[model samples]
Target: MNHESQKTTIANTVQLGSDLSVNRLGYGAMRLTGQPGNFGRYADWTAGKQLLRRAIELGINFIDTAESYGPGYNEELIASALYPYPDDLVIATKGGVLKTAPDNIRTDGSPNSLRRSCEASLKRLKVDRIGLYQLHRPDPNVPFVESIGMLAELQREGKIRHIGLSNVTIAQIEAARQIVDISSVQNRLNLAERNGEDILDYCTQHNIAFIPYSPLGAHPLKRGAPLANAEGILTEIAARQDVKPSQIALSWMLHRAPNIILIPGTTTISHLEENIAAASITLTADDIKLLNEAQVF
Candidate 1:
C-alpha cells in the first residue's frame, strides 16, 4: 500500500436513499447551541445564523441536527436561518431523545413519543415532510421494532421522506430494516475511534449512507493538547501537506471509505471553511496506510 504516484480522490456528492443527494462533507449544528452542555439557546443567535448561512454558501447541502440539541431551539434556528432552503439542500434530524438539562438525557423509543417528536420537528423545521428523520437512540424499555415501525408509519403518511438510525449496532440496523428501509446510519468515527468499522463496512456493502458524527473525536482536543499516536500521525501528515492537523484527520476519513459522510461542526467561520476544504484533499495510499495504522485513543 505504498503507491506514491497514485492518489485517491473522494467523491463530492453521495446519494441518500434513492432520491436525495448530499455533499460528502456536511455540517453538524450541535455546536451552535449554548456551551457547557448544549442545554439552552445559543447565546449569540445572530452569529449562529450567519455561520449557518455561510455553510450553505460554501457548498454544504447536508445539515445534521437533533431535537435534543437545545431541546428544540436548534431546529428553530435552522428554520430561522434557512427556512426557504435551496432546492438541493437536505436537512437530517433525530428524535427519541429527551433533554431537560445538560446532565440529564434519556431515550424514549416508543411510538407515542416518536410520533410527537416527529410532529414537533415538522413544525419547528417548517417543512411539510422531513427530508430525513432518525431515531436518536434505542430505548431499553421499548421494543426496537416498535420504534422503527413508528417511523415506518410516519414515512407512509408522508411525514418523513427517509428513515435513519443513530448510535446503533449492525444487529439493530438489520432489525430496523425488517420494519422499514434504512437510508443511513449515524455513528461516531474518527482516527481515535475505530469501534464502528464493522458497521461502516456493512453500510458500505448495502449502499447505505454512513454519516460519521464526531469526525474530530467526541472529546474536543485543545490547542497543543496531547493525543498520543493519533495526534502524532495527523501532525506529521499535516506538516507534510502544509494543512491543519484537524483537516488531515478529516481527510483521512474521506479516503477511508466511499460511503462515509462527515458532519464536523464548528462555531467559527475559519474552522467551517477549513472543514469544507478538507473534501478537496486527495490522500496517497501511503498516507492512508499510515493513518490506518495509527493508534486509537
Candidate 2:
C-alpha cells in the first residue's frame, strides 16, 4: 500500500554515462548475501533471490552488487532472479577486492586479476556487457592508473558499458578520467559519515552519479562525544516528523544532493520498503539545516 501511495519516491533520475539511466534511489544487493562482514554464503538463498525479484516489482531498476559479495554467489543469485533481464534494469557491479573476513577486505588490482574478475562477473550476471562496472577499491600494491587502464581496456573491448570507481579520492577520479570516462563513484556516505563530502561535490560538479553505499551509516559512530550530542538533535527532529530516526537519517541523504544515488542494503522486506519510501519524504529547509548541523564529524 505504501509503495503504491508513495508518489514522490525518487521522482527524478540522473543519467549515467552514454546510455544507462536509473532512478536516484536504488537498491544495494550486498546484504542479500548475508551479514555485514558478508564474506560467506547466504543463509537463505531462496529468500535472497525473491527479495531481488520483489525489488524490481517495486520499480527499482538499478541494483548495485559486487563480485566480492558472495565473491560470486550474489551475481549468480541475480541471474536466477532476473536472468532474461529487463530492458531498463541497470545491474551495476564492482570488482578488484576479495572478502576474507567481516573485518578484512583485500584488493587485487592487477590487470590479470581485474580481467579475470570482470569475465567471471559477466558470466555469473549472465550479461554480455555489464551496465555499470566499478573498480571496488584502489590497490596500494598496484599502480592506480594501471587499474584504471584495465577498465579502459575492458570498455574498448565492449565488456563494460559504463565505468565507475569506488572508495576513491578526487585526485584518483581525475587520474581515472584520463584513462576512461568515469560515469559514477561509489563511496561511504550517510547522514552520520560526512568524510566523503569533497568527493561527492566533485562528482556532482562533473555530472557523475555518486552512488552512496552505507547510506544509513555505521553504528557506534566513531565521533564519540560529538555524535552523542547530535543524536539528541536528530531524535528531536524525528519525533516531530512522526517517523523512525533511521527514516529521517536516510531522508537527509536523499535531499542532500540530487547526484547522490542511494543503495541502502537490507535483507528484510520491511526495511527494503522503508528505504524505498525515503525518497518520498521531503525534508524541509529547516530540517536540512538541522541534519547538517547534527553531522559533527
Candidate 3:
C-alpha cells in the first residue's frame, strides 16, 4: 500500500489535492498505445494489458493516459488490464489533443470537445470518477478558460475528482487558479529539455505535483558513452555510477526538485523494472550540478 512505502522510494510520496496520495515515480500510459508517434492501436493488447498490471506490482500507483493517446485505446487498455482497480491506484487521463494519424497530435481544447472526451473516458475506463483529469494542451482555436471551465464543471458534477494542466506556462497557472484549484502540472522535461524549469519551480513553490513526462529522451540512449560531446553528461555520470544513462537522467530528476513526479513509460518488462529502480539511485549535489548543465533547450 502507498502509506507503507514513504521512506522506501527516493522520489517518495506526494498528496494530490487532499485525498490522492501516489508514488512519485509513476507510469505513463501514452506509449502503451503502440508507437510510431503514439497515435496507433497497440500491436499487442495482451502485452499492453500485462505491462499495466506489472507496473502496479512495482509500486507505480499513478498511471497517466490521454483520450488522444490511441484516440481512446489507452484508456480502454487500462480498464482491460486493471479494472477491478486497486484501492491504492490512481488513474489520471488527459484530453484536448486528437490523433489524426499514426503520428500526429492536434490540440482541441474546446469545452464541448473536452466534455465529450471526459464522458467517453469515463465509459472506457469503467470508472465513475477519474482521479485526475488534465487538459492535454491549450487550444489556439478556443479560449483556454472555456476549456478549463469544462473540467471545473465536471469536478462539480463528480465526473472528475481533481484537475491538472499540461504544456502550460506559469501565467496560465495563475490565471487558471481564478477558475479552479490546480493540483498538478505536467510538461515535457528532461536532461535534454529545461523549458519547463520555470513551471516546475512554480509548482514546487505552490505544492502542486510537477509530473515530468519524459524523464529520459524519446529516442534510444547511447549509454555509458563518452561525455566529451557536451550533452553527454548523462553517459559520463552513468559511467561513474555503473548504471545506464537513462537511470542517471531519471535519478537526476528525482533530485532536481521535491515536487517532481516522473512518468517514464516503457513496453518491455526489463526496462520498466529498470525505470522503477531509478528512484533509488541517489544523486549527490555535485552530480546534480553536472547533469543540470547538460541541457539542449
Candidate 4:
C-alpha cells in the first residue's frame, strides 16, 4: 500500500454549502460528552479537551456536534477548549432535538422550539453566527416545511450561515429545498448500514454534501465475536492493506463517493489518529467488489 500513490486517487476536501471548504475526513464530537447516553459532561474533561485539540492539530477543521449532544454541554465544552478558534475552522452543530435524559430524547422542530435551540447553541458555542446549523430530526407532530422555514428565516437573519438536514429521505430533502437551500444531508451509513445509498446518490447528483455519522458499525461487536461474513472480508482486506478493519470500512466509503464527509467520533487520541489515517487508505478494486457484495453483520 503505497500511500503516496494512493493519495492522488482520493479527494481530501469537500465543499460544505457554497462557501466552506472542509476536509472530507472530519471529527464527530459526540463521544466527548458523558457516556451511557452522552447525557452529561464528559467524565474526563481534561482528556476530552486534549483529544479535540489533537483533532485540529491533525488537520481536522470540520467538527460535528449538536445542541442535544450534552443537551447544551457539548457546545460549551467546544467553546471552552477552543474558544478563540482558528479562522478556517468550521464548527457545524445541530438543533431541533432535545435530550432530557440519556434515555428520554425527543424531537422539537416547531418554530419556537427551533428558535430557542438555535439561540442557545449560539450562546454555548460563543459564535455570533453558526457556520453550518442542521435540523437534527424532523418532528412528526410539526410540519416539516414549517420547521425548515424557521431555519431559513434564521439564515436570512444571519444567525445561520448554512442549513442542513439529518435523518431525511429524498422526498424530505426535496420538500426542504422548496423552503430553502439545503447544504448537506446527514444520515446513518456505513459498511453494516447501506439503507442511505439512495439518499447518498440524490445528494451526489445535486452537489450537496452527504455526511455519514456512523462510518463504522453502530453497535459494538462483543469481545472475540465470530467473523464469518462481511466482517471477515473487512478483516482480510485490512490485513492485506496493513491497516485496521475500521480504516478499511471508512476508506471504502471515501471511495464510494466524492461527496462523502465522514465524522467518525472517538475519545482516545490513538483512535482519533487512526480515523484520520483512514483517509490515506485506498482500497483495491477486488476488495471493494467483495466488501460491496458481502452482507455486514
lDDT score at residue 187, model 3, on the 0-100 scale: 89
lDDT of 2: 0.82
10 residues in a row with least lDDT, candidate 1 = 220-229
Candidate 3 lDDT over residue span 84-165, tens digit each: 9999888999999888887566888998889999999999999999999999889989988899899999999999998999
Instruction: Report residue 258 deviation for candidate 2 (angstroms).
Output: 1.0
lDDT of each: 0.88, 0.82, 0.83, 0.86
Q: Number of clashes in model 4?
A: 0
Ranking by lDDT: 1, 4, 3, 2
Candidate RMSDs in order = 2.3, 5.0, 5.2, 3.1
User: Taking the tens digit of each residue's C-alpha lDDT, what string does model 1 give over 237-285?
Assistant: 8888888878888888888888888998878888899889989888888
In model 3, how large is the Cα lDDT of residue 195?
74
lDDT comparison, 2 vs 4, better candidate: 4
The better candidate by lDDT, 1 or 4, is 1
Supply the TM-score for candidate 2.
Answer: 0.90
- Residue lDDT tens for model 4, 95-210: 99899988788999999999999999999999999999999999999999999999999999999999999999899999999989999999988877898899999999998999
Clashing pairs counted in every model: 0, 0, 0, 0
Alpha-carbon lDDT of model 3: 0.83
In Å, residue 217's CA in model 4 sits off its true spot by: 1.4
